[model samples]
Target chain A: MTNDHHIRTRLRDKIVGIAGCGGLGSNCAVALARVGVGRLVIADFDKVEVSNLNRQYFFADQVGMPKVTALRTNIHRIDKDIMVDSHELILNPDNIPEVFNDCDVIVEAFDSAEMKLMIVETVTEKMPGKPLVCGVGLAGWGENNDIGMKVFDNVYICGDHLREVSPDFPPIAPRVGIVANMEANQVLEILLGKMNDGNNTQ
Target chain B: MEITLNNRKETIPDGDITVADLIRFKNFTFRLLVTKVNGRLVKKEARDQVYIREGDDVTVLHLISGG
Candidate 1:
């Protein structure tokens, strides 16, 4: 096969599942779609609010729309032919496996620490050997270079690894985008079987 | 006793130190954190009971959010 065909074939056979359709999930979906991922399974029960416009991938007009549907619409806008399995429901440990069973990689993009930990723990436990990409400590307007990636067993975590959210430090677009892109890149790396080259951990 | 904390070698008084005790010893005040010992997760409720031994790899990650 030609090099171009080989690249297309690889992207066309992989599926990614995102746990939240907020900033990280929505942006990651767009990146994956642009790269021609075969399918995406996205879940989010919350609706867009005016506050999410700062970092999330939703326009003001999309406020009040369920995040999953809004994200689906947005992803289609990027690549109309990309297949998306959108779920508009609150995800719990009991149902996560069912929703994302076929995914080769799962991205944990929840906003709360509790939810992030829950998804990471549940998915790792329920689906041993499946790789999970998660983000943490990307808050504030600190130096974007602080964001980095680390690999622990089957889990890949991306972010600054410091600077928790506070009244003074808030989640903004630039830093969040950096971490989200890192997560997306990690997914691509895992799918392409390049995870063992020794440069991914940061 | 000596243990590897986040990959750095550190020495503490020889005895059994629960995950909580180690956190206290390290002065980790961050509220949003996840602890793993030897590659297994130590949930919040189990921190006080989970013990760390010599040569055990412990990772304490703080989970905050921007996205």
Candidate 2:
């Protein structure tokens, strides 16, 4: 195999923190680990449930396990050398900074609207200038083409930019994976200093 | 009378209009929405208090849960 020094040396040195180890967090963590991100800080207060198997990376056997711990095990299965910092604690505005202090880029992967807003607000307030990759509007089986990226200062929002979850429209695996992978790609792009202004890869 | 809504020039009533009013006027029914005026985030509670003037850029983003 040809050696890619840049990806092995530079990319592996970066640290990424993922908030909320649900579908987005779990999938994104695996993507990053496959690409060889040096360290990962994953925080989540919840445990794995059967419903999460639809999109989340955890398996059926992993149910009832704490999400952070389960995620760490999954990521290590991909890259045992990758450093994993798993925190099984709820992240609020008051403690976000402390939990994600060592991370270079923080990924907002919460499922609730209020929690998403709180993470964005708290991160922007306390960690000014830190890059944050966030996911929004990845509901339903809408056209995958609608999935896009939007950049605001240091915050990168990835999703279809429409279609909230409803009785008629639910969060399926295809759309969720598209958004999750977009978020993971953004983290890698930001780490490699390759991200530019405007939308990327609709 | 006119302001840029999501980068498209639109006309609103010739008077003060808050972000909440704009959201209603545009018929954005999404429960989870994020609004920013001129690149600054406007909290949900403050959307009613924050007014939009002419020539300002307004972006409204909808938040959803799948991943």
Candidate 3:
């Protein structure tokens, strides 16, 4: 393997806090671990359900496990040296301050609209300058609508925007994968300060 | 008067309205979350009262999923 000292030196010691450890969060966390993110704080108040086995990295044995714990197990399986701090509670007004305190960036990965808004509002109110890259509109069907990318300052929104217009696509794996990768790419860009807000890839 | 849904422009009567009012007028089901406006995601509590001005662009999204 080529010694990619640049990525290692840059990603080393950078702290990323993920708010939801479901499809997008779990995938992103694993990808970041592979690349060499110094520390990852994974928080999810949800437990693994039988349905999460499809796209998420959790195993069949971890079907009833807390998502954070399952995600930690998955990440360790990939890279045992990667440091992961698992929080077994939902992100809310009370504990958000400490959850985001040392994070260099925040990844919003919840599936519920309410939770997504909560984390965004909490971060905006508490840490305005901290950048957040989030995923949205990835539900439903069709490859044409499942991909989109946009960036604004520290905020990047990904996924499909068809919930209102097209009432067909239900949130699924293909949709989630395309959007999740977009989010992970944004995280890498932001970490390296290579993101230009004007770029919109849809 | 005109309004924009997501981003595409559309015709509408000229009036001051909140996002919730417009969404309700369209008979939209209250399910997907509205995270950012013009670029910022908003809290659920503020969604009802968030005022929409002329020529403003809004992006709404959800954060939860099983996968």
Candidate 4:
């Protein structure tokens, strides 16, 4: 039962912000907390519902709870010491800056295409050099090989650029989980890699 | 002029086309676009002002989806 004492200590001071508490954000938050990220700023305007259970992290009992609050409670179950600051409201271009300005890296886990575009545009424009791990398209199934990443300076986009979820192509658990965890992995790589080799000006 | 776009070689019919024109000509309507010219980030506002040159390495990626 040995823990990653050294890795944990290194990550204990870092903060990660998640822009949505849906399939991508909730799971990424859990993964980051497990790896010892010290603080989290989670924002979501919606409440947990039965429909989201297929991919999101909320328990059946937690339905009707605001996504941000529900995710914070679930994260605490993994590690109570982790600090969580949750905002339960819609995130437009205006409030995003005030809410996530201090996070070391921001996770864009929104469901709508408009919100996704807005987050990327706003974060890259306003935050300047902040690292953003964003999920693009993981709708339907069986294109595992196609699920790769693209880099645009500070933003890392994971998932196929095509395929938006619709009535015909809905998001499922496995694909969502894979991309969500990929975002988490990117967060750690950015954080720990920076720690290991200082900042490499890109 | 020919340019490397998203790793593929593409020929742009216009001689002096900006990033905004390329996006419109290519019909890439997705708003979640991130454009890079020779590794330098070109913000959304500057896309119309940034021009694409021959042999330039350009990347216009639809980094997210609306769904």
Candidate 5:
């Protein structure tokens, strides 16, 4: 197949499940839709707030709306042809397989440390064969440039080294966008089997 | 000398190396976000002058919230 055909065929009908429809999740959903990932499964139990307006793509009208629903709306607005399954709930062991069984990749976007760790550990255990890319530190205003992925076989963590001494940084969309897109790209690379260097490449 | 990292137990040279000294050696500046240490949470002011032991576990977690 030609290079163009190869790329298209690689992405066609691929299913990616995104956990957390906040900044990282929302932006990743949009990026995947634009990239023609075919179907997307996005989940989040929260809603957009006024504080999220600074960096999130959602508008004031969507402030009270469930993040999953709003993300579904955003994806639909971007590409109606894309199939998105939106879940307004948290991801846990009980539903991980059911929610992500058909997914080619899983994107973790939980904001809280405990939640992120829980999701990461649970997903890693439940779906050892599937690929996962988690979003990590995109904190601070002017100091968020290091975006990369840590690939351990099929599990990947994107962002910066998440240690307490790291810093008290804030989230910005442009910065989040960079890491989210990189996560999405890593998903694509995994699908293409070009993810051999997934770990240190970040 | 050894310094604690993310709370994971590591054997390092015993000395007065502070957490700041360890972070600098890693080429990590003062802007990255850290969330947890040794599987526990750490505050901002404790980033420096936190004396580490040879076998102490030090975990560093960054604050990551989406846009």
Candidate 6:
């Protein structure tokens, strides 16, 4: 079989899942939408608040709306043909598999440390073969270019993997957007078979 | 005991060390770490209960979530 090289049609059948709808999740979805990912399964149990506007892909009008729904609407604005399956509920180990089972890749964009750990651990354990692009240690502004990416077998982590968010260093826009798009880029690489497989990887 | 820690060879004086014990022994004070022993994920609650044997492959990733 021959490979499809056309940029627009290559991702026509790909399905990507986003596990959070906050800063990283929203921004990542937008980036993926722009790139024409076929389907996105997004889940979140929160609403878009006014404070989230500083770094999230939500507007003031969408403050009271559920993030998954709002993000879906926004993604449609970019490409109405792109299918978005939005789930508005708290995700746990039990429901995670059912929610994102068919997704080719999953993005972990949770804010709280517990949720981040839960999603990463769950996906890694249950979905052994699928790729999980995650964000960690992305805090503060562009004082330094410490944001980096870590590659494991099935897990790809983006960030410095150290700095924690605090009063002195809050999660800002540019750096967060960078990590979010990095995650989107990772998904593109995985789907396009650009990632280095375990072949001869000793 | 010798084991592969993050792809690097390391020696642990204790032959049998629990995941929690290893974390403490190594001073892994990071609140968020996704640990795996032999490609199997070990959650936070199970760290103390799970033991790392000789020649085990272990990975402990540091992470922070604000977005």
Q: Pick the candidate with the highest DockQ.
A: 6
Model 4 clashing residue pairs (backbone): A111-B67, A112-B66, A113-B65, A113-B66
Docking class of 1: medium
Per-structure clash totals for the candidates: 0, 1, 16, 4, 37, 0
lDDT of 6 by residue, B1-67 (tens): 9988877889988766898888998899887898999999998889998989889999887767688
Please give the CA lDDT of all the candidate structures.
Answer: 0.85, 0.85, 0.73, 0.85, 0.69, 0.87
Residue-wise lDDT of candidate 1 within A43-120, one digit each (tens)? 999999999999998989999999998999998888788899999998999999999999999999888888887887
TM-score of chain B of each: 0.90, 0.93, 0.69, 0.89, 0.55, 0.90
lDDT of 1: 0.85
How high is the TM-score of chain A in each model? 0.92, 0.93, 0.88, 0.93, 0.86, 0.92
Residues A1-202, candidate 2: write the lDDT tens digits.
2334546576687899999999889999999999889999999999999989989999999999999989999998888999999989999988899889989999999988778878887876678778999998888785878878988767899987677667798777888888888999999888775635422222
Candidate 6 wrong stretches, greater than 4 Å? A1-5, A195-202
Judge candidate 5 against the unseen true structure and give its global Cα lDDT, from 0 to 1: 0.69
lDDT of 4: 0.85
- Per-residue CA lDDT of model 5 for A41-148, tens digit only, reads 988888889988867768889989998888888888987988889888877778878988899889887766666666655665567657878777676544554656
Better of 1 and 2 by TM-score: 1
lDDT of 5 at A102: 92
Q: Tell me the tens digit of each residue's lDDT in model 2 across B2-38.
A: 8887768999887888999999999998777778888
Candidate with maximal lDDT? 6
How far residue A91's Cα lies from its native spot in candidate 4, in Å, is 1.0
lDDT of 6 at A179: 87
Give the Å shift of residue A161 in candidate 1: 1.4
Over 4 Å off, model 2: A1-3, A195-202, B1-14, B54-57
lDDT, residue A131, model 6: 90
Colliding pairs, model 1:
none
